[model samples]
Target: MKTSDRRTARRGAMEQAESGQAAPAMLWRYYAVAIMLVACFIVLVWRVIDLQVINHEFLRSQGDMRTVRVEPIQATRGKILDRNGEPLAVSAPVVTLWANPQEAQENDEGWRKLADLLGMQSDEMVKRLRRHKGKEFIYVQRQLSPETGRLAMDLKLQGLYAKREFKRYYPAGEVAAHIVGITDIDEKGQEGVELAFDQYLRGVNGSKKVLKDRRGYVIKDLSLLQDAQSGADLQLSIDLRLQYMAYRELKAAVEAHNAKSGSLVILDVRTGEVLAMVNQPSFNPNNRDSMNPSGLRNRAVTDLFEPGSTVKPLSIAAALKTGSFTTETRINTSPGFLRLNGQTIRDARDYGTLDLVSIITKSSNVGTSKVALKIGGEAVFETFYQAGFGQSSGIEFPGEAVGVLPNFTKWQPIRLATLSYGYGLSVTALQLAQSYMAIAADGVRRPVSLIRGGQQGVSPQQVMSPGISRHIREMLETVVLKGGTGTRAHVAEYRVAGKTGTTHKVGEHGYADDAYNAVFAGLAPVEKPRLAMAIVMNEPQGSEYYGGEVSAPVFARVVANALRLLNVAPDRAIPMVAGASGSDSKRNGG
Candidate 1:
């Protein structure tokens, strides 16, 4: 029975397979599939047109509004500290007022109130508002006083807001102005150590995306792009106490002598650190009214002048190093006046067959010239160069002048003679301090430093033999004694050693008839020197322009205070030193 049913079923299947009635239904199925595909393509095209053309700009703006508010996170600038962590330059908070012009213009009453509080003319304020009609932000005023800032905020203008920003301030004021320098309104360094270490002193600003409401107040922070980092705190080698002392003394001397300008530098002989550097005509960093662009210069490292007799010890070093003379060697300086090369090199008085030791004590120009001739021109220039003359002191100071030493090939007889007495080549006050440091440190010149601990393990370069340096220092010690040129530079409790210099100022054409630079360079506690300093008084008036008179007294006062502050022990007893302490010849390069 099942076989017979299977045969009928097969016959039915074959019949259905061959049936023509199924054709239209299959065609209808194909048409339905095709229609569905066409409909999908149309929907895709419509969507493309909607996004790429119809709603492009609107969607873009909406996206930007949601994610693109830049909220800046203020960064604090670094503080500059002295060796003992005393604040030299610090950043303090100040208020800056700003406004959205469009919002403020919409609030006429608020704008009027703002104008009144800001002390601005209504017409001018209206004109400014018109100029920047729809601007998002503009500074209404910057660096407002705390009281003014509070009063302006009290007005509560629609778009006006007061924000805090750090402004640089110098607490040490004029006392450390030359070294600490000044910063601009944006807290960018403008001069001195501030300018030198700007990258370290300036901070990195940060910003983030923030959501703001209709009133322009922040709603939520979307994401932080960068985190603000405060600048690195700097520790300098300058001792604040010494800086104050030097500044006080230098200022007093400048005022007392009625000098045009003055510069003083103190160095630690043991480590080659600049302990103090000050200049006269200094401006207080705290008061902008006291600021003069000309007074802003750091003269200790910038101004160049012929070293005058300050370089006498260097000449002596040259003579000894060249095997031309010993400390006991004698030179005939009889009659004083030397005529050569249409120029005359003369001593104040004929020193008369003086030995090297006696020559230094007397500051005999003829004697120094004789030895310089004996050593030859090349030797003299080489000696000065080795002593850090005509070179940057490596103090990292901005605009530091490298003193001038003419090529030895161009030296004439007169040039060599003049150079012997420190009239031809030029040097800065800092250079003089460095050279004297060489003498104090046994002729080994180390790189001068402004950073604390920067001089540790610093290998020194030998510029002269220890023997000759010792002898030179010993002889210099005599210069501050009873019959020397720098007796006024002597301290009461220390064995002082130094040299005095007076050079006619070089004017636009030639040497000025009256203008002069009186300079003193010395090392204190000669037995074991601790500090080396240089002082320069420019164009001292009122009948006293000698280095010993104008600059040495400053040196004495500053050094005495500095030694005491450092707790240095006395190396010598107070002696009855007697001298006039005046320049020997008005016209001579003493």
Candidate 2:
């Protein structure tokens, strides 16, 4: 009993000491943990304040530099329409493939596939990327169709993306190339009406801010910086139907005659609006690969040549305007040739004596020279000036020529005679057409226009007396009848009136003996003239360099179709003038 009591007392004493030491250790542990938690909380609060308040803008800018981007929004170009609302040029949707060169550098296989799809060499594409290594953006391929672009984008090449764009499309192709013109890859107008009205036809580009992911995928549109404005549609005065007809005929004629080049223009006599303007050796706006300096030229308004016999009618008009001659006036073309100042002006044959009407019908250079000598130089000059010679056509076309009309004040006797018979001066096809247009419009010279509603508020100029104009018109009608030089230009069921011109081209020394410019300018429906037309063939090969043979037939074919298409009423019965003999001769001012 004594030993057990001692052991129990010692154990109780040890337990009481251990319990006191445990309580102090537990208290210290709780205090240390509380202080550590407070320190952590303070550090976290300071960090939040620094980011949200102190360095907020800096942090936000750094983040935005990686994710936000400004991008361009392409605007669509305006359509070029014909007067009848047919589209000559329109914007077609396309896609351009671009790349971030830095990211694309690592994807060789993808790039190879992309290059193959684009019809490009893989090595060349790789070299291009290497050249633009540090650049963020580069064009991989531009102007692909939507389907093709989708196929290209589906490849999922690294750093590659597609951009929407508009490409200019020509519905009529080369038929309207010289008139409607063409646009560059960027949709900027390059030639013709496109160049003439670039500002009105080009649209304003817009911009927007966007958010992108690390992979360069656009996540969301942040904001629009600007709105795009589409360009205004341009309505041209051309009738596409007439343009096609003219182009087909002119091209065929040029090929048939083996001509170096050619041009044709048709105008509305009443409104002065150009109905059709065509050039051969034409380039297709849709086929840029075939374009050349020659094909790109708008020859009708830009090229100049001697007027030849075409201006003889104007010379007679000048004489009549001076009251020195009348429709009944007679001129002796004895021996069919005249020698003045050592220069011999000869006609096709010796039509010994002829009236004013017969002079034009035969296209007699001798008769015209006699008339011009009587009228003096001033009268002829004034008439030519009034008929729009030596002046711009007022159409505002790019590269339009103001032809050479020598000042009559400086003329010698020989010069005056030459000018009278359509020499010693030059004129563009458009100018020639406009001059004839004045005659066709009852002597009212209206400003020529390429745009549908252009040349507004311009008054019609009375270039010749009404009676004289009518008489001239009547005489021109005779030129398309039997025994006339331009009988090939005669249209069926239509009273055709016009002139034939065969001018010698200027050579290194003087007028070339072999080279020539064949031309025909005229109007139709003699009772109420509606259309004025001009056809010019440059350097026709073989035996067909005469205007009557080379150009007049093209005029007849095109006008025949044009008149019918326009629903112009037939004025008279068909004339049997198609078989009329020899064309106006090159040696006879034909």
Model 1 per-residue lDDT tens digits across residues 1-590 = 69999999999998898776788899999999999999999999998899889988877778768655888878888999999999999988888998877777543666666678779876777777778877978888888777888888777667777677877888999999888888889888889888999999898989888877665656788899999999999999999999988888888889999999999999999889999999999998989986898899999999998889989899889999978588999999989878878877888787689999978888888898888888889898998998999888989799999989888889988889898888888899999999999999988898899998756665778999989999999998887777777777877788888998999998899989889899999998887889999999999998889887788878888888899999999876658456644345344555
lDDT of 2 by residue, 419-483 (tens): 88788888888999999999998898999999887479887789998888899999998887778
Model 1, residue 169: distance off in Å is 1.1
Our tally of clashes for model 1 stands at 0
Q: What TM-score does each of the candidates earn?
A: 0.86, 0.90
Name the candidate that leads on lDDT.
2
lDDT of candidate 1 at residue 420, scale 0 to 100: 81
Counting clashing residue pairs in each candidate, in order, gives 0, 1
The lDDT values for all models are 0.86, 0.89
